[model samples]
Target: MPETVFEVDVDAAPEEQPDPIVNRWHPDVPPVERVSPGEKFRVECLDWTGNQVNNDDSASDIRDMRLDPNHHLSGPIAVDGAKPGDLLVVDILDLGPFPDNEWGFTGIFELDNGGGFLTDHFPNARKAIWDFDGVYTSSRHVPDVRFAGLSHPGILGTAPSHDLLERWNERERDLIERGPDDETAVNHETHDDDPPLALPPEPNEVLLGDMDDEAVEEAAEKAARTIPPRENAGNCDIKNLSRGSRVYLPVFVEGANLVTGDLHFSQGDGEITFCGAIEMAGYVDLKVDVIENGMERFGVDHAIFKPGNVEPQFSEYVVFEGYSVDEDGTQHYKNANVGMRRACLDAIDYLTNFGYTPEQAYIILSTVPVESRIAGIVDLPNTCVTVSVPEAVFDFDVDPDSLAEISSEGRGRAARPS
Candidate 1:
């Protein structure tokens, strides 16, 4: 018998729902429920796109989708005994697809508006409908490839303290003020293209009773958008954080207002492209416990989590290599954004060899699970990145047996070193 303390329903009507789905994580956002430490609870999360998208949505729909308040998060569940400088231990006990219908989607954004890795190669928008059957998911758009589900919450963290929020705002504002000309400014823009700047809270919106109008306004303006991961671990999108994983987060505000959303049925490392992984609406069971003064004991400030029971499938890979150094001898290795783009283009080129057009290849890459790795970074002038696509993902024969093994010996034989 689990000591369940709170429950949230993502599909409920606005008036009927117990907890409000917030677009941002702020300490001022009133918690939907309160629970003592060591209590268990369940959260029902809407898809990353906030249920605005559906299986019937077309590529055009994705292209025209609004970017504000992108991921709808489910909580800020206050822990009774938690406080700043403490640690919150979230034990992920179970994660599964929606009970009514087990379905999800993978999407690729248009290149003009903050595109993904292969933006130049794949400028158009696309989508793949996924059907989750137990532990596996298959997409109708990309047939013959079924991947094991590694469901996990894409966004999970505690609300930042007033000071931390100010620091984040200052740092990001500085980068934005630096303009896009600076090499470091390319992917450092803090907020998404269109933030809900003018959108005020709904009339029925619930807020913390203790806050006044000035405090509410401050919170609304200063709340960090859920785009990038921070010290508190919001929007980390680590796919391995599935059932059985234990996540430790540094507490910032009183009661450690924990929030969670952006459930993904599956995702590859780096989530290379935009619009993100197999976005899904699902139920997550978590056991919340507090570790008093654990941050000082552990000597860490950021979030850390152990891998879940789910393991990535190992198969023969058709590897593609990319370099950050261009023909002009200019190096862009300092920023990973450049390396990701190069690797994506390399992957697109390789996919074209197998009878896939640039568009089709890009869609396949976005929908499929392809591992991206930083192969090397120490080699001064140039940094190396590699994208590994499993040979097993293709139903047709790619002749993996004829390809060189992914080892030094295979490369040595090809070079014929005496």
Candidate 2:
């Protein structure tokens, strides 16, 4: 019999209704049954903005958007028997439409505002308008090719840490106190009547210019360590995180808090345009279960699974920035692509032990490996690489039973926090 995994609806409700689990921060002992390798559960996910936008939308609509504190994720379902330092294995089946009609994801504002690497080139204005058809075709594009710009949530994280929350609270307060930078004397041509402004630079807040290198480094380190994703979940934008591939994520806190809302119908590898995969009212089905004495929590950061091999092949996506030394004793900029090639080579070497011939591996990689993608290159240098190898790839004759065994073993290994 074909193994049947659970399918998450992806489109359910806006999560605007009052359910204790919808927006709360605490973990819950869910009502779902324990999931095995073949068994699956469906989760209904809410839109990122809780269904705040309409079909007839504009840049102003998103710009004036208010992100609510109370408006957070739905399920952090305490996996049955899941303990601290265990990985929550998730199989991403598919991501598609819901009952309602809203297409694409959000978070373009951040990408435009230098929060991401492409901010410099990508226009910070609301470029396109999504209509009722749920398809965003361009009037300027070539004929017959109706390109519907799909988008997904770029930010889906758990609840915030206490210290981080407190720090954020202070930042909010500073913003409220300082208000917009109303310095008319220093205003530039771009400074409109209502120019955007961030929080005031407090002594303890982010270090300003002229701070010592060590101090600056300390600030960056603190931010990286203490700051969880927007909410506590972490910057998890795995588009494949929909519902088929049993995904294993590390458990940082006692309760493996999971916030699922960033829903995208179809997104390209890099999400290059910065605003495809966009949709608001949708649902995600999930079953949060636990693993006993799990050991691969850290490995959750870089999920490694072999397609057919009994000994799972390792796979990881890493971005590297390249700098070449010029003849003038100075460093000249090399393309990020060069750096990506090196990283890809390294990853290939890692997978070689799992049974990939260099040639076979190259072909498999060329076909399956997703390049130029960014889980988050906002802070890192340009080069970004995202790759995945199924456990079955190792076995020439990947039968049903073998597939099951490999999947289960990968899951078992993945469950243990590394």
Name the top TM-score candidate: 1
The C-alpha stretches of model 2 lying farther than 4 A from their native spots are: 1-16, 20-40, 67-72, 105-116, 127-233, 253-255, 270-276, 287-289, 296-418
Candidate 1 global TM-score = 0.84
Model 2 quality (TM-score): 0.47
Query: How do the predictions measure up, each by TM-score?
Result: 0.84, 0.47
**Which tens-of-lDDT digit does each residue in 104-128 have in candidate 2?**
3333443323222233323343323
Residue-wise lDDT of candidate 1 within 1-418, one digit each (tens)?
A: 3543334455664224455666665677777778877778787777776665767737666777766656677777889899899999999988877778689877677776546655545566777778888888877666556767678899999989879877887777775555454354333343454222222222223333234657666666666777778888999988789889999999999989888888888877677557658888877888889998989989998998898766667677877776765324456645555666667776766555555555555655554667777888788645677877777766665455544433433222111000
Q: Which candidate is the best by lDDT?
A: 1
Q: Counting only residues 3 or more apart in sequence or on different chains, how many pairs clash (N, Cα, C under 3 Å) in candidate 1?
A: 0
The Cα RMSD in angstroms, rounded to one decimal, for candidate 2 relative to the true structure is 16.7
